[model samples]
Target: MQRIVLERAGGTPVTKRAHLGAVASGNLEVLCEPPAGDGATIVVSTSVDGYEPVWRATLERFLEQHFIAAAIEINDFGATPAMVSLRLEQALELAR
Candidate 1:
Protein backbone atom coordinates (compact mmCIF):
# COMPACT_ATOMS: atom_id res chain seq x y z
CA MET A 1 0.00 0.00 0.00
CA GLN A 2 1.06 3.60 -0.66
CA ARG A 3 -0.39 6.89 0.54
CA ILE A 4 0.11 10.62 0.22
CA VAL A 5 -0.90 12.97 2.97
CA LEU A 6 -1.55 16.63 2.29
CA GLU A 7 -1.70 18.96 5.24
CA ARG A 8 -0.47 22.35 6.35
CA ALA A 9 1.46 22.98 9.55
CA GLY A 10 -1.77 23.76 11.32
CA GLY A 11 -3.91 21.06 12.95
CA THR A 12 -6.46 20.88 10.23
CA PRO A 13 -7.81 17.60 8.95
CA VAL A 14 -5.40 15.91 6.61
CA THR A 15 -6.24 14.76 3.11
CA LYS A 16 -5.09 11.23 2.42
CA ARG A 17 -4.91 9.25 -0.83
CA ALA A 18 -3.90 5.62 -0.98
CA HIS A 19 -3.63 2.85 -3.53
CA LEU A 20 -3.70 -0.72 -2.38
CA GLY A 21 -3.91 -4.18 -3.93
CA ALA A 22 -3.91 -4.86 -7.64
CA VAL A 23 -6.35 -4.74 -10.55
CA ALA A 24 -6.48 -8.44 -11.29
CA SER A 25 -9.56 -10.60 -11.14
CA GLY A 26 -9.36 -10.87 -7.38
CA ASN A 27 -7.81 -7.63 -6.24
CA LEU A 28 -8.85 -4.09 -5.36
CA GLU A 29 -7.69 -0.48 -5.29
CA VAL A 30 -8.56 1.62 -2.31
CA LEU A 31 -8.18 5.40 -2.23
CA CYS A 32 -9.03 7.45 0.78
CA GLU A 33 -9.51 11.17 1.34
CA PRO A 34 -10.70 13.35 4.19
CA PRO A 35 -14.45 13.37 4.59
CA ALA A 36 -16.46 16.47 3.65
CA GLY A 37 -18.32 17.39 6.88
CA ASP A 38 -20.07 14.04 7.15
CA GLY A 39 -18.71 10.88 8.65
CA ALA A 40 -16.81 8.21 6.82
CA THR A 41 -18.23 7.23 3.44
CA ILE A 42 -17.30 4.29 1.23
CA VAL A 43 -18.01 3.96 -2.47
CA VAL A 44 -17.21 0.70 -4.14
CA SER A 45 -17.01 -0.11 -7.85
CA THR A 46 -16.60 -3.67 -8.94
CA SER A 47 -15.95 -5.22 -12.30
CA VAL A 48 -18.39 -8.01 -11.52
CA ASP A 49 -21.20 -5.44 -11.83
CA GLY A 50 -23.80 -7.16 -9.62
CA TYR A 51 -22.45 -6.81 -6.08
CA GLU A 52 -22.67 -3.09 -5.60
CA PRO A 53 -25.35 -3.26 -2.94
CA VAL A 54 -23.57 -5.82 -0.84
CA TRP A 55 -20.18 -4.24 -1.33
CA ARG A 56 -21.42 -0.81 -0.36
CA ALA A 57 -23.17 -2.14 2.69
CA THR A 58 -20.21 -4.14 3.85
CA LEU A 59 -17.72 -1.33 3.23
CA GLU A 60 -19.91 1.23 4.92
CA ARG A 61 -20.22 -0.96 7.97
CA PHE A 62 -16.52 -1.54 8.05
CA LEU A 63 -15.70 2.16 7.78
CA GLU A 64 -18.15 3.10 10.49
CA GLN A 65 -16.97 0.37 12.76
CA HIS A 66 -13.38 1.44 12.36
CA PHE A 67 -14.23 5.11 12.81
CA ILE A 68 -12.45 5.95 9.58
CA ALA A 69 -12.70 9.67 8.86
CA ALA A 70 -12.19 9.51 5.13
CA ALA A 71 -14.07 9.00 1.92
CA ILE A 72 -13.00 5.69 0.48
CA GLU A 73 -13.13 4.72 -3.17
CA ILE A 74 -12.72 1.02 -3.85
CA ASN A 75 -12.14 -0.43 -7.30
CA ASP A 76 -12.60 -4.12 -6.94
CA PHE A 77 -12.37 -6.96 -9.40
CA GLY A 78 -14.26 -9.82 -7.76
CA ALA A 79 -12.42 -9.94 -4.46
CA THR A 80 -14.21 -11.52 -1.54
CA PRO A 81 -15.23 -9.52 1.51
CA ALA A 82 -12.37 -10.90 3.55
CA MET A 83 -9.83 -9.88 0.97
CA VAL A 84 -11.39 -6.47 0.73
CA SER A 85 -11.18 -6.10 4.48
CA LEU A 86 -7.55 -7.02 4.52
CA ARG A 87 -6.72 -4.59 1.72
CA LEU A 88 -8.65 -1.82 3.41
CA GLU A 89 -6.81 -2.43 6.65
CA GLN A 90 -3.51 -2.31 4.88
CA ALA A 91 -4.37 0.93 3.17
CA LEU A 92 -5.53 2.46 6.44
CA GLU A 93 -2.31 1.43 8.08
CA LEU A 94 -0.31 3.07 5.36
CA ALA A 95 -2.41 6.19 5.60
CA ARG A 96 -1.56 6.49 9.27
Candidate 2:
Protein backbone atom coordinates (compact mmCIF):
# COMPACT_ATOMS: atom_id res chain seq x y z
CA MET A 1 0.00 0.00 0.00
CA GLN A 2 1.08 3.65 -0.67
CA ARG A 3 0.63 6.79 1.40
CA ILE A 4 -0.50 10.24 0.25
CA VAL A 5 -0.47 12.90 2.92
CA LEU A 6 -2.47 16.04 2.19
CA GLU A 7 -0.90 18.20 4.85
CA ARG A 8 -1.21 21.96 5.25
CA ALA A 9 1.82 23.01 7.18
CA GLY A 10 2.50 26.16 9.25
CA GLY A 11 -1.12 27.15 9.37
CA THR A 12 -4.40 25.53 10.21
CA PRO A 13 -2.80 22.17 10.03
CA VAL A 14 -5.35 19.86 8.49
CA THR A 15 -3.80 16.61 7.44
CA LYS A 16 -5.75 14.17 5.32
CA ARG A 17 -4.10 10.87 4.68
CA ALA A 18 -5.68 8.72 2.00
CA HIS A 19 -4.49 5.13 2.06
CA LEU A 20 -5.22 3.85 -1.43
CA GLY A 21 -4.82 0.41 -2.93
CA ALA A 22 -5.46 -1.50 -6.15
CA VAL A 23 -8.71 -3.33 -6.73
CA ALA A 24 -10.13 -5.92 -9.10
CA SER A 25 -10.07 -4.84 -12.75
CA GLY A 26 -10.59 -1.07 -13.02
CA ASN A 27 -11.52 -0.76 -9.36
CA LEU A 28 -9.87 0.71 -6.25
CA GLU A 29 -9.73 0.50 -2.46
CA VAL A 30 -9.44 3.64 -0.34
CA LEU A 31 -9.40 4.51 3.36
CA CYS A 32 -9.19 7.99 4.86
CA GLU A 33 -8.52 9.83 8.15
CA PRO A 34 -9.52 13.48 8.58
CA PRO A 35 -7.07 14.56 11.30
CA ALA A 36 -9.06 13.69 14.36
CA GLY A 37 -9.43 10.60 16.53
CA ASP A 38 -9.41 7.02 15.38
CA GLY A 39 -10.43 3.37 15.78
CA ALA A 40 -8.57 0.84 13.70
CA THR A 41 -7.87 3.63 11.25
CA ILE A 42 -8.09 2.03 7.83
CA VAL A 43 -5.39 2.59 5.21
CA VAL A 44 -5.92 2.64 1.39
CA SER A 45 -3.60 2.63 -1.57
CA THR A 46 -4.05 3.94 -5.18
CA SER A 47 -2.18 5.09 -8.32
CA VAL A 48 -3.68 8.34 -9.53
CA ASP A 49 -1.26 11.11 -10.35
CA GLY A 50 -0.79 14.27 -12.49
CA TYR A 51 -4.39 15.25 -11.97
CA GLU A 52 -4.38 17.77 -9.14
CA PRO A 53 -7.48 19.57 -10.35
CA VAL A 54 -9.36 16.34 -10.65
CA TRP A 55 -8.34 15.29 -7.17
CA ARG A 56 -9.27 18.65 -5.74
CA ALA A 57 -12.58 18.71 -7.55
CA THR A 58 -13.31 15.17 -6.57
CA LEU A 59 -12.52 15.89 -2.91
CA GLU A 60 -14.82 18.90 -2.95
CA ARG A 61 -17.64 16.94 -4.42
CA PHE A 62 -17.11 14.06 -2.06
CA LEU A 63 -16.90 16.35 0.95
CA GLU A 64 -20.10 18.01 -0.19
CA GLN A 65 -21.82 14.66 -0.23
CA HIS A 66 -20.25 13.40 2.99
CA PHE A 67 -18.83 14.45 6.30
CA ILE A 68 -15.52 13.45 7.84
CA ALA A 69 -13.50 14.28 10.96
CA ALA A 70 -9.92 13.04 11.32
CA ALA A 71 -6.68 12.71 9.40
CA ILE A 72 -6.75 11.21 5.89
CA GLU A 73 -3.87 9.58 4.11
CA ILE A 74 -3.80 8.22 0.53
CA ASN A 75 -1.65 5.65 -1.18
CA ASP A 76 -1.99 5.50 -4.96
CA PHE A 77 -0.65 3.23 -7.67
CA GLY A 78 -1.46 4.61 -11.12
CA ALA A 79 -5.16 5.42 -11.06
CA THR A 80 -7.26 7.79 -13.20
CA PRO A 81 -8.96 10.93 -11.95
CA ALA A 82 -12.37 9.30 -11.86
CA MET A 83 -10.96 6.26 -10.17
CA VAL A 84 -9.10 8.42 -7.72
CA SER A 85 -12.28 10.31 -6.92
CA LEU A 86 -14.21 7.13 -6.41
CA ARG A 87 -11.45 5.77 -4.23
CA LEU A 88 -11.45 8.95 -2.21
CA GLU A 89 -15.19 8.71 -1.65
CA GLN A 90 -14.89 5.10 -0.72
CA ALA A 91 -12.22 5.99 1.80
CA LEU A 92 -14.36 8.73 3.27
CA GLU A 93 -17.34 6.45 3.38
CA LEU A 94 -15.34 3.87 5.22
CA ALA A 95 -14.23 6.51 7.63
CA ARG A 96 -17.82 7.42 8.34
Candidate 3:
Protein backbone atom coordinates (compact mmCIF):
# COMPACT_ATOMS: atom_id res chain seq x y z
CA MET A 1 0.00 0.00 0.00
CA GLN A 2 1.09 3.55 -0.64
CA ARG A 3 1.69 6.00 2.16
CA ILE A 4 -1.27 8.13 3.18
CA VAL A 5 -1.14 11.73 4.30
CA LEU A 6 -3.64 12.60 6.98
CA GLU A 7 -2.86 16.30 6.93
CA ARG A 8 -1.51 18.61 4.30
CA ALA A 9 1.56 20.76 4.85
CA GLY A 10 0.99 24.31 6.05
CA GLY A 11 1.47 27.37 3.88
CA THR A 12 2.48 30.97 4.54
CA PRO A 13 -0.19 33.04 6.28
CA VAL A 14 -2.08 35.85 4.59
CA THR A 15 -3.04 39.25 5.90
CA LYS A 16 -6.82 39.01 6.33
CA ARG A 17 -9.24 41.53 4.99
CA ALA A 18 -11.54 43.71 7.10
CA HIS A 19 -14.93 42.63 5.79
CA LEU A 20 -16.76 39.50 4.66
CA GLY A 21 -20.21 38.41 3.45
CA ALA A 22 -23.10 40.78 2.70
CA VAL A 23 -25.39 43.05 4.69
CA ALA A 24 -28.56 42.20 2.79
CA SER A 25 -31.47 39.95 3.55
CA GLY A 26 -30.48 36.35 4.25
CA ASN A 27 -26.87 37.42 4.27
CA LEU A 28 -24.40 38.77 6.81
CA GLU A 29 -21.17 40.75 6.82
CA VAL A 30 -18.10 39.89 8.87
CA LEU A 31 -15.25 42.26 9.66
CA CYS A 32 -12.17 40.72 11.24
CA GLU A 33 -9.09 42.29 12.78
CA PRO A 34 -6.07 41.15 14.72
CA PRO A 35 -6.66 40.43 18.36
CA ALA A 36 -5.38 42.71 21.10
CA GLY A 37 -4.27 39.84 23.29
CA ASP A 38 -4.64 36.07 23.46
CA GLY A 39 -8.11 34.84 22.46
CA ALA A 40 -10.53 36.22 19.89
CA THR A 41 -13.23 38.86 20.15
CA ILE A 42 -16.54 38.56 18.25
CA VAL A 43 -19.21 41.22 17.90
CA VAL A 44 -22.57 40.73 16.19
CA SER A 45 -25.09 43.30 15.02
CA THR A 46 -28.44 42.26 13.56
CA SER A 47 -30.77 44.08 11.22
CA VAL A 48 -34.12 42.48 12.12
CA ASP A 49 -33.95 43.63 15.75
CA GLY A 50 -33.49 41.79 19.13
CA TYR A 51 -31.76 38.42 19.80
CA GLU A 52 -28.57 40.00 21.02
CA PRO A 53 -27.98 37.38 23.69
CA VAL A 54 -28.44 34.48 21.31
CA TRP A 55 -26.10 35.97 18.79
CA ARG A 56 -23.48 36.73 21.40
CA ALA A 57 -23.65 33.25 22.90
CA THR A 58 -23.45 31.52 19.56
CA LEU A 59 -20.56 33.61 18.31
CA GLU A 60 -18.70 33.31 21.60
CA ARG A 61 -19.07 29.55 21.57
CA PHE A 62 -17.96 29.33 17.96
CA LEU A 63 -14.81 31.34 18.66
CA GLU A 64 -14.05 29.35 21.77
CA GLN A 65 -14.50 26.02 20.01
CA HIS A 66 -12.33 27.05 17.08
CA PHE A 67 -9.68 28.67 19.28
CA ILE A 68 -9.70 31.66 16.96
CA ALA A 69 -7.60 34.72 17.72
CA ALA A 70 -9.07 37.75 16.02
CA ALA A 71 -11.51 40.58 16.50
CA ILE A 72 -14.55 39.81 14.36
CA GLU A 73 -17.58 41.98 13.66
CA ILE A 74 -20.63 40.29 12.15
CA ASN A 75 -23.43 42.23 10.56
CA ASP A 76 -26.19 39.67 10.55
CA PHE A 77 -29.29 39.84 8.40
CA GLY A 78 -30.94 36.52 9.15
CA ALA A 79 -28.36 33.75 8.88
CA THR A 80 -28.95 30.46 10.64
CA PRO A 81 -26.55 28.98 13.17
CA ALA A 82 -25.18 26.55 10.62
CA MET A 83 -24.72 29.31 8.13
CA VAL A 84 -22.99 31.48 10.69
CA SER A 85 -20.64 28.63 11.57
CA LEU A 86 -19.83 27.94 7.94
CA ARG A 87 -19.32 31.63 7.18
CA LEU A 88 -17.06 32.02 10.19
CA GLU A 89 -14.98 29.11 8.97
CA GLN A 90 -14.78 30.57 5.52
CA ALA A 91 -13.83 33.99 6.86
CA LEU A 92 -11.06 32.49 8.96
CA GLU A 93 -9.83 30.40 6.07
CA LEU A 94 -9.64 33.49 3.90
CA ALA A 95 -8.00 35.27 6.80
CA ARG A 96 -5.20 32.76 6.72
Candidate 4:
Protein backbone atom coordinates (compact mmCIF):
# COMPACT_ATOMS: atom_id res chain seq x y z
CA MET A 1 0.00 0.00 0.00
CA GLN A 2 1.08 3.56 -0.70
CA ARG A 3 -0.05 6.71 1.02
CA ILE A 4 -0.05 10.18 -0.48
CA VAL A 5 -0.95 13.43 1.19
CA LEU A 6 -1.66 16.67 -0.66
CA GLU A 7 -2.61 20.05 0.73
CA ARG A 8 -3.95 23.11 -1.06
CA ALA A 9 -4.93 26.65 -0.23
CA GLY A 10 -8.23 28.52 -0.64
CA GLY A 11 -11.68 27.07 -1.31
CA THR A 12 -15.25 27.10 -0.11
CA PRO A 13 -15.36 25.18 3.13
CA VAL A 14 -17.29 21.89 3.22
CA THR A 15 -20.16 22.18 5.63
CA LYS A 16 -21.22 18.53 5.76
CA ARG A 17 -19.48 15.19 5.60
CA ALA A 18 -19.86 12.74 2.75
CA HIS A 19 -18.88 9.21 1.82
CA LEU A 20 -19.03 7.74 -1.64
CA GLY A 21 -17.99 4.72 -3.68
CA ALA A 22 -16.54 1.38 -2.62
CA VAL A 23 -13.06 -0.02 -2.18
CA ALA A 24 -13.24 -3.21 -4.13
CA SER A 25 -12.51 -4.74 -7.53
CA GLY A 26 -10.79 -1.89 -9.34
CA ASN A 27 -12.80 0.72 -7.46
CA LEU A 28 -12.35 3.18 -4.62
CA GLU A 29 -14.12 5.16 -1.95
CA VAL A 30 -14.05 8.86 -1.09
CA LEU A 31 -14.76 10.43 2.26
CA CYS A 32 -15.08 14.19 2.67
CA GLU A 33 -15.56 16.18 5.80
CA PRO A 34 -15.24 19.74 7.06
CA PRO A 35 -11.66 20.78 7.42
CA ALA A 36 -9.99 22.18 10.48
CA GLY A 37 -8.72 25.21 8.57
CA ASP A 38 -9.38 27.27 5.45
CA GLY A 39 -7.61 25.04 2.96
CA ALA A 40 -8.10 21.55 1.62
CA THR A 41 -6.29 18.39 2.66
CA ILE A 42 -6.40 15.08 0.88
CA VAL A 43 -5.09 11.77 2.10
CA VAL A 44 -4.99 8.93 -0.37
CA SER A 45 -4.33 5.31 0.48
CA THR A 46 -3.95 3.15 -2.59
CA SER A 47 -3.21 -0.49 -3.15
CA VAL A 48 -1.08 0.35 -6.15
CA ASP A 49 2.49 1.51 -5.63
CA GLY A 50 4.62 4.18 -7.39
CA TYR A 51 1.63 6.15 -8.59
CA GLU A 52 2.14 9.31 -6.62
CA PRO A 53 2.47 11.48 -9.71
CA VAL A 54 -0.72 10.11 -11.22
CA TRP A 55 -2.57 10.64 -7.99
CA ARG A 56 -1.26 14.19 -7.68
CA ALA A 57 -2.19 15.12 -11.21
CA THR A 58 -5.65 13.64 -10.95
CA LEU A 59 -6.32 15.38 -7.65
CA GLU A 60 -4.84 18.70 -8.80
CA ARG A 61 -7.17 18.84 -11.73
CA PHE A 62 -10.14 18.11 -9.52
CA LEU A 63 -9.08 20.73 -6.99
CA GLU A 64 -8.52 23.29 -9.68
CA GLN A 65 -12.11 22.88 -10.79
CA HIS A 66 -13.92 22.39 -7.49
CA PHE A 67 -11.60 24.12 -4.99
CA ILE A 68 -13.46 22.86 -1.98
CA ALA A 69 -12.06 23.19 1.52
CA ALA A 70 -12.57 19.75 2.96
CA ALA A 71 -10.69 16.93 4.59
CA ILE A 72 -10.80 14.25 1.94
CA GLU A 73 -9.87 10.61 2.36
CA ILE A 74 -9.52 8.23 -0.56
CA ASN A 75 -9.20 4.50 -0.17
CA ASP A 76 -8.24 3.02 -3.48
CA PHE A 77 -8.20 -0.54 -4.70
CA GLY A 78 -6.50 -0.54 -8.07
CA ALA A 79 -8.96 1.98 -9.44
CA THR A 80 -8.39 3.85 -12.69
CA PRO A 81 -7.78 7.58 -12.82
CA ALA A 82 -11.19 8.25 -14.28
CA MET A 83 -12.87 6.31 -11.50
CA VAL A 84 -10.94 8.23 -8.91
CA SER A 85 -12.07 11.54 -10.37
CA LEU A 86 -15.63 10.37 -10.55
CA ARG A 87 -15.71 9.27 -6.93
CA LEU A 88 -14.17 12.54 -5.80
CA GLU A 89 -16.74 14.56 -7.71
CA GLN A 90 -19.51 12.43 -6.29
CA ALA A 91 -18.22 12.82 -2.75
CA LEU A 92 -18.00 16.57 -3.15
CA GLU A 93 -21.47 16.77 -4.56
CA LEU A 94 -22.86 14.75 -1.68
CA ALA A 95 -20.90 16.89 0.76
CA ARG A 96 -22.45 20.04 -0.60
lDDT of 2 by residue, 9-65 (tens): 221222445556655556655655555543222233445445565556665565455
Highest-scoring model, lDDT:
4
Clash count per candidate: 0, 36, 0, 0
Candidate 2: where are CA atoms >4 Å away? 1-20, 23-29, 37-49
Tell me the TM-score of each prediction against the true structure. 0.71, 0.49, 0.70, 0.96
Higher-scoring candidate on lDDT, 1 or 4? 4
Cα lDDT tens digits, model 1, 1-96, are: 322222112122335677777778888888876767555656666777566566666665665556556666777778898898888888777765
User: Ten consecutive residues with minimal summed lDDT in candidate 2?
Assistant: 5-14
Compose the digit string of candidate 3's lDDT tens values, residues 1-96: 111111112223235766678977778888776665545656667766665566666676665556556767787788787778878888888775
- The order of the candidates by lDDT, greatest first, is 4, 1, 3, 2
Output the better candidate (1/2) by lDDT.
1
lDDT (CA) per prediction = 0.65, 0.50, 0.64, 0.92
Residue 12, model 2: lDDT of 26
lDDT of 4 by residue, 1-96 (tens): 999999998899988999978899899988899999889999999999999999999999999999689999999999999999889888888887
**Which sections of candidate 4 miss by over 4 Å?**
none
The TM-score that candidate 3 achieves is 0.70
Task: For candidate 3, give the lDDT.
Answer: 0.64
